[model samples]
Target: MAIPTTNRAVVATASGPVDVLTDTELDVPTPGPLDLLVEVRAVSVNPVDVKLRGGALPGGDGPQVLGYDAAGVVLAVGDQVSAYAVGDEVYYAGSISRPGSNQQFQLVDEKVAGRKPASLDFAEAAALPLTTITAWETLFERWRLGADSTGTLLVMGAAGGVGSIMVQLARQLTGLTVIAAVGRPESREWVRELGAHHVVDRTDLLAEVTAIVPRGVDFVLSPFSAGMVETYTQVMALGGSVVAIDEPEGVDTLPLKWKSQGWHWEFMFSRVIHDPESTAHRELLDEVSRLVDAGTLRSTLGTRLSPIDAATLQEAHRLLESSATIGKVVLAAG
Candidate 1:
């Protein structure tokens, strides 16, 4: 297959709203020494994409491409790349510093990429990377929860992309009793199917959680709204740990001081941004791929949009910003 000089991409011109997301043709980027040039077959929308598109964060000087999760076939590789070859099927949450997978072809560092699960297709596989990396790092790395650790885990917002995978990883990979906090009846069932041992309504969070685990939960993974931090602090057991992935306006630490509870933030982009040489993302994705092929893990793709054009991406952004999305929305490139 010949590499084209120009390929289609979804570019954010100014970043004010979904309207800023534009479909355009751009020069295909050449890979660096440690990079893989992947022909992107599928990509998924994440909250960070919405944030970046909405101008919540600075958009730099020129049109910025904004996608993180992707599953594709490697079309080329740089001299220093070793883990992947031209034909390898790969999945990754790429670096925020570079142009993203919203383009038909993207250059990703080999250390941040992993073999795609043999059992899943591109769209399904694309939904796994960002959320899986977030969930895995939050559970084992940030909270330092071991596989043998036996305790109850309270997952706030347990039906969204990260929450869906977090519930599964905790239930399947650890001895933790998973208590998922969800607001809607449909979401409650969704989390239960994903291996949540118990479900509590977010509307009545503290009371519902207290009723189930009267003492308090041993660990808390809050991936949703930041307003629930206070409730989480109140419901956490002494020595319990809390890990959050959302950027809340402010979090007060006074409540956690007395109980000696710990709080940590898991940003999946940190490894790609700060430590590009680190292979932690690749290793974790490899594990996730194995689990997925073995049927221990499943993709959380909730919707699939076709063609990977501007309008479809805008719709995806709208759904994500609406805060009503369950699982993930993926776009497949033709």
Candidate 2:
């Protein structure tokens, strides 16, 4: 089938709250030779979108589309698109430099897109892409944890979107013990149910974590940084590493110097932006899809907003801004 030439989208006219978002028509983006045209069914919001929409970006402006994660059906393949065909259900967290998934039709590099899990709906599938990519890449690629390696992994902010999937992926895919750090009582149980071996409250983070891992954890991952590099440094075993998705809380690297500690930053959109070693992300998504299909990975959709409209998406953004959302928030098109 021929690809459409225009699309409906929610666009940000200027950086601010969700009120900046408006429904608009845009020229349908054409796929590059290596890209594919996706008929978007659902999209998930992340803090990164908030950052860009709020003018945190260096020089970003104009009517920016803010969604990163998406689940959709492939409508048309670019000339070089060899991995997928039209009508294939797919999911992806697109590049930060390009237009994102907040549109009815979007262009994405085929190399970074994965087949959606057959068992999940578009909303559930959308919830997995960005967080799953961040968690999976951070654990396996950055921290070097393997399926056969046995060690305890401390997950900070463990009830959030990425952490929810991180808990399940750690429990199901790796031999490592999963230590989930959550603040509230309900969040603790939530992580525990998702397969965390131990759940600690962030109110007294180091003490609670040490109580669970007397010898310290082998690795620590923070979904939202709150001086975690320094605070969690002591909770990691000697030679252990810390990885963060968000900016750290002004930590001094000196504390980690003696331990030869490694710090990593996971940005899932890097592949899509720079196109550096792009196929690696596609492979990662493939692996995540397999894990999901095998029931080893779970989507982290905590809230669902309908019809992918401006007002509903605004509410989703508001909920995320509250900083208490437990899991991924999704906007699904009817």
Model-by-model lDDT, in order?
0.89, 0.84
TM-score (C-alpha) between model 2 and the true structure? 0.94
Q: For candidate 1, write residues 4-122 as lDDT tens digits.
A: 88888988888687988898999888888999999999999988888877765444744888899999999999999989899999999988778889999999999999999999999
Taking all chains together, each candidate's TM-score versus the true structure is 0.97, 0.94
Per-residue CA lDDT of model 2 for 225-314, tens digit only, reads 665567766888888888878875575667777777777788876656676546887788788888778887778888888988788888
The collision pairs in model 2 are 6-28
Candidate 2: stretches off by over 4 Å: 2-6, 57-59, 273-277
C-alpha RMSD by candidate, in order: 1.3, 1.8
Q: Candidate 1 has what TM-score?
A: 0.97
Q: With candidate 2 superimposed using the best TM-score fit, by how many Å does residue 268's alpha carbon deviate from the native?
A: 2.3
